[model samples]
Target: MIVSGKLLVSLSLLVLVFKVSHGQPLVPALIIFGDSVADVGNNNNRTTLVKANFPPYGRDFVNHQPTGRFCNGKLATDFTAEYLGFTSYPPAFLSQEATGMGILTGVNFASAASGYYNWTAQLWGAISLDQQLNYYNEYQSIVVNMVGEAEANAIFSGAIHLLSAGTSDFIQNYYINPFLRGYTPDQFSEILMRSYSSFIQKLYGLGARRIGVTNLPPIGCLPASITLFGSGSNQWNIKLNQDAILFNNKLNNTSQTLQKSLPGLKLVVFDIYQPLLDMITNPSDNGFFESRRACCGTGTFETSVLCNSRSVGTCNNATGYVFWDGFHPSEAANEVLAGDLLAQGIDLIS
Candidate 1:
C-alpha cells in the first residue's frame, strides 16, 4: 500500500486504547531487539563474535566491566526502562537463568550486532528479525507460565516492545546503491518500511500492543562515515549528514501507517533524528563541542578499523561530543536523546 494517502492518516488517529483501569496498576516489562543501539549484550561473547563486550565499550559500566552494550554507559533502552521505574538495564534473556530473574524484571533479547536483514552478520550471522521474533514468542510463553494472566496483563499493559535500528541497514546493504531491487531511493525505503510494518504487525499478532520504535540516526555524521567517506570535496556529504534525516522521515511516515494498520495497538515514536540533528546543527546548545570530528580515531574518520582497539583509539572527552565511537552515541547523547523522547510524554497504555 502507498503509505501517504489520507486514508492511512485518518486511521492512525482512530486509536482504540486498551483499558487497564480494572484495578490493576500498569508495570513495565521490556523486550528489546535490534542493532548495536538497543543491544544489552545478547551476543554472549562465547568467542570474539560480539561487539561492545570488549574494552572501553563499557568503561562507564559498573565496575568498569564490559557487558557488550554499544554505548559508553547505559543504552537508550536501558534508560527508557528506568524512566518507567523498572530495572535501568534489562537483563538479557540468555542470561536470565544465571540472574534468576523473571520476565517482569524486563528481559532484553537485543544483540549488539543483529539486524533485520539476513546479510548483516557475517560468518557468525547476526540475529534476523524473524529470529528475534521467535525469541519474543519464547519470552511470552515464559511470562504466561510465571505470573499467570492477571499480573501478566498488568506488566504486559506496560510491557513495551522497543526496536531501534537502521543506520546499519544503509551502511551494510541499502546504500550499496544497487539496482537489484530496481527501486529509487524513495521506492527502496518504502519497501523497507513495509517490511518493518509487517514485523511490527507480527508482534501485534503475538500480543505486543505497545511499542516504542525509532528510525536510523544520522548515518553521515558517524565518525566511521567521516573518517572514510567525509574527506571528499563534498564536505556536506561527509560532515553534514542528511541520509539519516531522510531515512527517519520515511520511518516516521511508516510508524503513522503502522498505527493505523492495527487496532488497539499503541505505537510511540522515538525520534532519534532531531536530537542528533540539534546536536550537529546546534552543538553548543547541548554542550557538544566536537561536532564534525570523532572522539576516537586513528588515520581518518576513526574508521571502524580504528575503533577495534582501545589502546590506539581513545577519544579526548566523550561528553564534549555526541558520538561515542564512530557509529554509536556517547552516554551523554543517549541520555539526552532518550530524555527528550520521554519528555515527549510516553506512558503506559491504559
Candidate 2:
C-alpha cells in the first residue's frame, strides 16, 4: 500500500528530527515487560498458554472488549503514558497496526504473559524479564528505523525510560524461593537478583538512563494467594503474604545495588511495597473495598476464571473493587497507582 501523505510526513519528520538532535528528547516512549500486570496484549496475539484475551477483561473501556489485557480496563503503564502526553495507552509495537509507525511520545513493549525465563510461556508463564529484553531490542530497532540514529539517541537520553517488571518473577514464576527447583529461598533470591542486575546493566548499555522501576507489590495479598490461603474464608492471610513482602524488599534492595553499579543510571524505585502494604492494611485510605477476593466470579471465586468467562460472571462494579481478576488490578486501581507513581515528580534522569 502506498504510504499516506500524513505518514510520509511523519516519517520525514522522524528522520529530520533524528538528524538534528544529537541527544535530545525526540519524545518519551513507555516500554513494558513482564506478566499480566504490564501485559498490554501479547497473549491476545500469541497462541501461548499465558493468555487473557477473554471477555470482561476490557469491560471498563470502550466496547467492553477484552484486549487480552489482564485488567478490567487501562493498565498502570497506560496511565503513565497518558501523563506524559500520549494518545491512549501506547500499544505493543508488535501489536500496533504498523510496526514502523511512531507515536509522538510513547510505545508499549510489554507483551502479555511474558517472563524472564524462556520456557515460561509454555507453562502459561508470564513474559520473562529476559524475553522482555528481546522485545526492547526490537523496540530499539523500530525507533532507529523510524527516527534515525541521531534522533533515537536523543530520545533515549531525553525520554524517560520506564521499567516495570519482576513481580511476575514472584507471582507467576514458582521460583520465588526456588525451593521447588531444590534451591533455598536465599539461594534463589541470590541468583535471580544477579541475573536481574545484569539485565539492568544491559539496558543501561542500550541507552536507558532514566529508569523507573516499580518494586513488587504485596504478592501474598493477590486474590489468587488469598484464595489459596483463605480457602473458603474471605479473609486474606497476613502471614502467607509475608513472602511477597520479602520479595518486594529483595527487588528494592537489588535496585539500590544496581544504582551503585551503574553510576550514570538514574534509578527511581517506585516503592510499591509500602504502598500496597498500607492499602491492604488500610483499604479505605488506598481506596479498596475488597482486598482478598477478586470481584470476578469463577467456580472457585478467585481469578481462576478469566474476567470474561462465558460460564462465570463478572463483578458488577469494577471501580469499587480493588482487583479485577485473581492477579491483576482494576483500571480504577491502576489509575490511582499511576497518580501515586507520579506523585513526587520523577527527576531520576533529568
How many residue pairs clash in all the candidates, one count each? 4, 14
Off by over 4 Å in 1: 1-26, 46-50, 96-99, 121-124, 176-182, 231-242, 299-310, 345-350
Q: By summed lDDT, which 10 consecutive residues of candidate 2 come out lowest?
A: 299-308
Q: lDDT for model 1, on a 0 to 1 scale?
A: 0.65
The model with the greatest lDDT is 1
Candidate 1 lDDT tens digits, 262-301: 8888887777776787887788889888676655554234
How many angstroms is residue 218 displaced in model 2 relative to the true structure, after the best TM-score fit? 1.1
- Each prediction's Cα lDDT score? 0.65, 0.65
Please provide TM-scores, in order, for all candidate models, with all chains considered together: 0.82, 0.82
Give the per-residue lDDT of model 2 (tens digit) for 237-321. 5654666566567777888888888877777777766666666577777777766556687523444234456635566887767
